[model samples]
Target: MSLLSEVERDEERRAGARGDGDVDQPANAQELAAMSKLISGSGLLDVREGELEVQQRNPNSPLHSVKAFEQLNLSPKLIRGIYQMGFMRPSRIQEKALPALVADPPINMIAQSQSGTGKTAAFLLTMLSRVDPNENYCQCLCLAPTFELAKQIGEVCKRMAAYMPEVKIGYATREEKYTRDSYSNHHILIATPGTAQDWVMRYRIINMAKLRVFVLDEADVLIDQQAFRDISVRLSRHLSPGCQILLFSATFEEPVVEFARTVVPEAATIRLKRQELTLDNLLQVFARPASIDIKYQYVTLTFGLFGLAQCMVFCQSRREAEVLQKRLQSDGHDSLVLHGQMEISDRASIIRRYRNSEVRILITTNVLARGIDIAQVNVVINWELPVMRDRSPDFETYLHRIGRAGRFGKKGIGLSFVVDDTDERNLRQIEKHFCTQIHEMNMDDPVQLNELQKKVRK
Candidate 1:
């Protein structure tokens, strides 16, 4: 099928043209406005207290969740920055982990929470609370699986520590160049495992022995990679005996959890959130794919129907994203493409614009999948199902991809394309793994399309 065979090339112009500043809009614009106002006033309302099972390794000190940010007794500057950043109260993860995170004598903890639950903010606050801004030689360290994630964490911490000017945070990303004099004096360090390991082991610029709190974000992914796990273990050994360690991930398979226990031994584990085996607020569906052109057609149709609230289409490769963005734009859909290969500055700019609703659709790989929150995004499409390097289904990636939608517990739609028998098998594996049935949706059916429209409106 030709890309333009099903629809006229200039039909959008012939119909009603979108005026300037009218191209981007949510499913319900008024509703989004109200939600934004509420968020600015009371934090994200959707992430209210939910189910969390707590366990204390030590029976003598029973840790309880704190409902208010003040209960943790954070620094005045930190509290002022938190409120100014529009976080009026603690998130579900914050409420559960703050007490243990900001506790006296610093606690070693393993916390698991799904994407968008404020895990980054929770841990950043802990890092800030632990650091002594006056006399700093990298007192706190946070390592992410990727440099982009490391940069994202740095930005969040900067916002949280805006009122505390004396606090300094440094990055040791692959692209970053830092000297001993420049990097050694920061209060906190955020970097990728390989780079941080190099700085600590080879260059000896980062004195890990001085670290007070060491955080491993995206712990499951880190442990799954042999190279990263090895470096992480070596780094753990270098930390001060009394240094606190925090490991956080969206989903933790049992084996990974066990490995985490070894790293943060006797850790006060805060399973504040389970893997979220299922996203109750997200509508899941799968579509059968045909020719390449036909797949593009279905994607364009999807954007027209439910994508005004914005959409993220995940591609398996960078070229795939470029191809899809080209096809989508040719069909009169203005969109953006983001991939890990792009410069970090470009990636950050795209994410910020997407969050501000400047871009309606973003085509990319798994870079935005983990722990990046954009409230207006309500639709996520797996242009191709994610698979591991060994050709097996990557269930964790699938969960994170779809999680981009229904963010902050809002309603969302997630669709996956099954291109061949292999994709079909992968989809089946994902469904079985999550224990959630994905509807086989036929966009060709008029009644089904109407129902989807109604769901979006609802």
Candidate 2:
């Protein structure tokens, strides 16, 4: 069974064990009697892309099925494009967000889903469905916090528009020049907010007269840095009347939601309480040592023994990333270094080598932890736990780090080395924050170590 289904079963068992009556249950029977009710009192999260239908294991509860493309009533061309992209399935966010987008009097969405849960595709499809190909006035403008993420959205939009004969996609970033004269023929503009905002202020190039949808991909980051006021709302001024706004991110905080509400008045809200696993099919393991030195020793040993599979090691700082890359190379490991401080070309080269499996292990910082897809990454190691304003690493960052390994439900492994009690505390906090149960196996355990060795041999 799928992890979601397993979680549902666990919830059911928990509910059954609670002898308390309706008073203890969060929702009343009438509330639960609708087409479906959420398992954990979180709203029904829609899932698409599979043959599964919404059905109840027992009559007392209602379950919402993940809506497939067939149920979505998407246009033939759109469906063909989605199929061409090899996305024969829709993610839970897409399933839930699409219907809500199409509903008459569109409901605004603020989804907290994992990065690779196909979140980009979900919003892009909605944008495409709402846009008019004939109207080439930047009908939809999607903003991302980082240049990399903006480029990613642009790429996806291009692919989804492949089957659509007339759609044109243009992206503007600090790196790419998309001026008024450059892409006036385009139908959609995917861009970093900083660059897009710069253009709007300079050329007024983005014609809001034809705009219909506005999307903020990494809303939390935008708000966290206090950059949304200058980045997001500046573009909001270019929106046509009654434009539907959507915000999707892996991490959700109260401040970000409040900021969103201020920008989008009269917006309906939906959040996925389950916090969709971005790293599905990933095996997360932690190595605990008596000290930090021992942690490094074990990691190096693991790397040396397993050879390599084009891995990524995440560090907390640019300096640490560089140092780790040097250390690994000195130890006779083929590796590269990347951080936001590096030139864009260097970053790109590192990414290319890593993707092509030319580089065995790439050391980087959080800049690589978001929206960068590397399919050949069979392993990811967190050399140092990320520091967040909160006590734990952002759940989204954790997912994104591990997500590098597994793509399209392929098996992958994420190893986090816990060197001290502080690391253990942080790990526990992360697991608790996400309500995920991660199994702990000792690298020192003879049986477990031997089993792992045997598997590696195969």
Candidate 3:
């Protein structure tokens, strides 16, 4: 059947399923029994096509089952630390790995799990489990690919250490001053790989004789850059005997697996895979046009009308990101631009504004796609396709872009404009990967345009 015909039939089926009885009728015993019988007789009463019915079937409802924490034969100090953070239950990943790390002889671990799955606390608890309050040398180290992520991991460490006395956690950045002695006295050192490497070479301050815990967060990004191997090599040269290493990231790509083998040779591996990580909270829609220029025009028009709390536009290059941001601002969109070429402080400030709702829209490259958490963002627009190693647009990048929205139990929308044969191929790849149907939202159709206008007006 044609797409329009299918949509129409679905709508008709829904209207018919409502039945002749008054929906607002009070539920007396007889009325309730009749309604139950009617629904049980036809699957139409249970199956729904809209967002509301799908939410009714959500497996991740707030009142959903809270997975219990495994009984790790942890010491009194570590149990006290976990309680200090007010964490009573473990996420799925945490439940599986905590006991293994706390056992008689700690085993190194490498985990491939999606973001927002509590990877931070899983590793933090393990690190805290190994820490000795009496020792002053850096005993645990967690390295992140970005300064922002390093700072976030440091904050998590602080929260976990609230009840523990005299335990210090520190992070380093070129923009910030951190004394070598300050880090020398820390029990946990959370740092960016670059900053950590700098400290290793400059101050030679890391006393690795007592260090026993090491973690690499977002391992895929570092694997892609070969920074994972470089950092692992440098760290191995300084690590104490019997040190335990952990590698964590969203995707279990092949390169990441190889890097993990070298870093944690006999480490236990865990994977959540793509199926579990795909966000069900997003409503994905595509807009197809006769040409790229028309696609650009439609994007400009739609974002102008959408008063979203926060929106991100993903482009292919620094030039494209800048030009698009300037054009949108000229059209009175008041958007900010971000990319690798900008200064560090400037990028952080733009992110702060977008996070705080000071700016409604941001245009940038893929750097912001991972490890940066902004819950208020509700819309993501793909202005340009992500290029893969084969020099073609990749579907995985598209998934990550759309995944940014509808996070943490909130509804989100993802819109993309496909304008050429190449774009069509990219769309097919996306559909095939998810086994999902991507509805094409026709901008030229008067009915759709009117509906969009009505939504924006409200």
Candidate 4:
């Protein structure tokens, strides 16, 4: 069916439900006020105000069984790859998302869950499963927001498909590392939206005719950015009608979710409750600095106060990241900086070094916020608050920033530097939105610092 027809049918289905007494009831003033606070504070849209929605296009799908990975009846090579990766059982999101993802007749999906929840692996498995190993062309296309993230996803795909020698994976970013000829023959391609569009329109490098699966790893971020959003929509139009589109993210604003629905109509959606959005294993804390200069001092002090294996310092702008990196380095602390303005190759190299533990502290902008997983990062320092262009508190960015740490069930720490009343208000809003408290640290008192170190060590 055409995209328009599919969307119309979905609207008709929803309309029929409304006719059958399934209409959305209006929220009273108090409820509306609470919801408004939640969205504004959390930077996350509460889908229907605290309700978690899960929809499956095919309710009676045989693949809905949440059994062992072996029970999914996947290929031996793919199964061997799974076991080789040391995955004994599926994660919650994986179990819920995989069946529909790997089911036959190819259905679209929209899945949301907390970070470090195996969402990447879930979609990677589907991409690997759906590929025709015998065929030698780009069958699966995965798009990420940043080059670092795209490279990380490509690495994961290579590892997961290690046992399957026939699955060729390619990464298309601004860097000319992967040649056009190499990309054309790749069985699976992971790329940034701009580069992907360029390859399709200008270079004519990517052939979308036989594309089977199109996965958007950070769907919310991609849809929010205007440049990426426009190119992504154009690329989707070029793909064959039967291609499966899968959208995955840690958080989805309500409007972005709606835009995704329109883009991929008849998609199955999996969303988590508001309470389930925050990572429980991550210990969140805030340090109120007397001045902006003191904020830098506190970051330096944190290094000595805790057993930090590695940490990422998040700055609001490129200038902040650069200045902080220079200051930290001058203080004899080893650090590196990453931002959008840097060369793609340099950013990729910095990410590689950070992942390898060559650099202990990596100061960066929002580039590293979403899906780059570094297991050794024990702490995340918000050098500056994440705010939107209008200077509103960015709760979604906060979640992604803290999410960089505490990956894969490991304990992590998130520390934000609040220097003024504005910062304090934003922090409080985040706490209220999540319905969780961020332990306050008194940097003036050594005893409080010691107590925080003890908690972090635990």
* Highest lDDT scorer: 1
If both were scored by TM-score, which would come out higher, candidate 1 or candidate 4?
1
TM-score of each: 0.58, 0.52, 0.53, 0.54
Q: Each model's C-alpha lDDT?
A: 0.76, 0.65, 0.66, 0.74
Model 1: per-residue Cα lDDT over 83-130, one tens digit each: 888887788778878888888878888886654567778899989998
What is candidate 4's TM-score against the reference? 0.54
For residues 1-458, what per-residue lDDT tens digits would candidate 3 score against the true structure? Answer: 11124555455335435542111111222222222222222111211112111111123422222245436765566666766666767766565666666654777778865444567888988888888878878888888776766776788788877776677777766656877766677888887777777776778767555578888887776655566459756775677658888888655667777777777766766675233335576767788767655766777666655456778888755556777788778878889998766555566667767776888889887666544547777778887556553436566667777778766566666787776777778887878878887768887787876775454334
Report the poorest 10 consecutive residues by lDDT, candidate 3.
47-56
RMSD of each: 10.2, 15.4, 17.2, 15.7
* Candidate 4 CA-lDDT value: 0.74
Worst 10 residues of 2 by lDDT: 32-41
Between prediction 1 and prediction 2, the one with superior TM-score is 1
Q: What's the lDDT for residue 368 in model 4?
A: 64
Candidate 4: segments with Cα more than 4 A from true spot: 1-53, 59-63, 276-458
Clashes of each: 0, 3, 0, 0
Best by TM-score: 1
Distance from true location, Cα of 319 in model 1, Å:
11
CA lDDT, candidate 3, residue 383 = 77
Give the poorly placed runs of model 3, Cα more than 4 Å off.
Answer: 1-70, 75-81, 172-182, 198-202, 224-229, 276-458
